[model samples]
Target: MATILMITGDFVEDYENMVPFQALMAMGHQVDAVCPGKSAGENIATAIHDFEGDQTYTEKRGHNFTLNANFDSVEAEDYDALYIPGGRSPEYLRLNTQVIGLIQNFFAAGKPIASICHGVQLLTAAGVIEGKKVSAYPACQPEVEAAGAEFVHIEMDQAITDSNLVTAPAWPAHPAMLSQFVKLFK
Candidate 1:
């Protein structure tokens, strides 16, 4: 089993955070979920994003996700893989130099990374997606493309894996994304 590091923060999409956290744990993997400036036992407010036939997805308050590890304690070399969940968090997390550096370490080491939806924002900020084929939320297409990555838009439930990177548009793609990420441990 692999040790996985999942970075998330307040307003992260609920399913995107919890599903992968639990799914990876269920597979007998060790997963540490953390957020910048937060410590073990601290919680982050999550949001539920759902398609309600509106011009865009609708947001609702979701369960509080607890942090099992301290962000300041994370060392990328200690983990075999990285997971970045989508939502509004990436918009701000990407601004943290430590966060971006942490992501860069993963890429420099060639570890597998799985990012979905707006999580690509962090990847772009870290400058790790250059020339990579990625799939992200429709609204993130511009950012991904501008980062020098080829953005592949697909249905929300679909995912695309290119070598050490696996990405999806939204929570609906969790099943595929998780499978691909797990395969990286092989």
Candidate 2:
């Protein structure tokens, strides 16, 4: 089983984050939700995770993970790949120098990196998506491209793959996204 280090912030897309986390477990892969901060009993607090204005809010707590580890803590050569989920979390996560360093560590080693929704922001901020084809929430197209990536747009299509990277749209595309990501480890 592949040891997948999935990171998040204070608030992230709850469902999108959980689905893959659960799927990886079901597939017998080791998954850890690394976060920037924590709440009760060393667990991270994740709310509605809304960044666009604000619709509704709810707070759910997940166990504390590796917030201190950077690219130097774990090399890309150690892990098989990385999966990034969308949410306002990306905006905050991209700001973490440690996280950005880890992102680059993976790409430089040619390890597969899967990014969904606003998660693309992390890759963009890390300067690892350049010259690659990617897709996001549409509004983020400019940012992704500006980071040196080609944005793929389509209502229904296969996941976009560029070298060791994989990109997909929103939640509706999770099935395809998860399946494609699983194959990367095998």
Candidate 3:
């Protein structure tokens, strides 16, 4: 069983955060969810990003997700893999130095990393996606490309894995994304 660290923040996507956490747990993996500056038992607001035929996905208030671990207490080397969910969180999380360093540590140590939707923003900010092939929410195509990664286009249910990085466009690709990610443990 892999020890997975799931990083999230306020306004993280509801499904993106919960689905994988529960799914992996059901599969016998230990998934520890943490938010920067938050401790165990603290909750963060989740957002629902639904495609209501608007120009983009619509957002609404979602459930409160509780953190089961303390961010300050975790070290990247202690985990076997990393999971980053998408939502508005990445917009600001990308600017967090500690978050960026943690991400860099994972990349440096070659641990598997799974990122969805806007979560790719952090990978861009961390400078780890350079020269890698990845897939991200369509809106982040330019940013991924700008960061020196080749953005892959695929069906919503598909995912792309490049070495230790597993990426999906959005929550719709969770099944494939997590499946590909779990394979890294072998």
Candidate 4:
């Protein structure tokens, strides 16, 4: 079983963060969820993003997720894969130097990475998606292109895999995304 590292922070999408963590564990993979500046046992708030016939998604309070790993102790090489969930958190997480470095290390090691929705923001900030086809929320197309990567406008329920990266437009693509991501370990 692969040991995966999930990087997330406050306001991470509710489904995007919780579903993958639980599902991966149910599949016999070990997933350690962590957040920058937080230690193990700490908790982070989540937000639910729903597209309810509006021009943009609507947000609501979500469950509090607990961190199982310490960010300061995480080493990219210690895990086989990296998972990044999306939400408003990515907008700020991209500003963390350590977070960017951790992402870069994963890319340098050719480790598999599964990122969804706004999660691509971190990848773009890390400069690891250049020349790669990545899928993210529709609003992130500009960021993807600006980072020298081709932005793939995929369906909300679909996912795209390029090299070691598997990405989806949103939580609705969880099945497709996880299926493709797990294959990377094989």
Q: What's the TM-score of every candidate structure?
A: 0.99, 0.81, 0.98, 0.99
Write one digit per residue (lDDT tens) for candidate 3, span 84-164: 999999999998999999999999999999999999999999999999999988999999999999999988788999999
lDDT of 4 at 115: 98
| Tens digits of lDDT, candidate 4, 87-138 | 9999999999999999999999999999999999999999999999999999
lDDT of all predictions = 0.95, 0.73, 0.95, 0.97
On lDDT, the stronger of 3 and 4 is: 4
In the range 101-122, model 1's lDDT, one tens digit per residue, is 9999999999999999999999
lDDT string, candidate 2, 1-186, tens digits: 898878676556766677787888898887666665442234444434333454433335443232333333454566788989876789988998888988898888877778887899999999988889888877788998898788999552346777778788665677778777777775
Name the best candidate (by lDDT). 4
Candidate 3 ranges with C-alpha deviation above 4 Å: none
Model 2 residue 58 lDDT score:
33
lDDT comparing candidate 2 with the true structure:
0.73
TM-score of 2: 0.81
| Candidate 4, pairs of clashing residues | none
Backbone clashes under 3 angstroms, per model:
0, 2, 0, 0
Global CA lDDT computed for model 1: 0.95
Scored by lDDT, model 3 comes in at 0.95
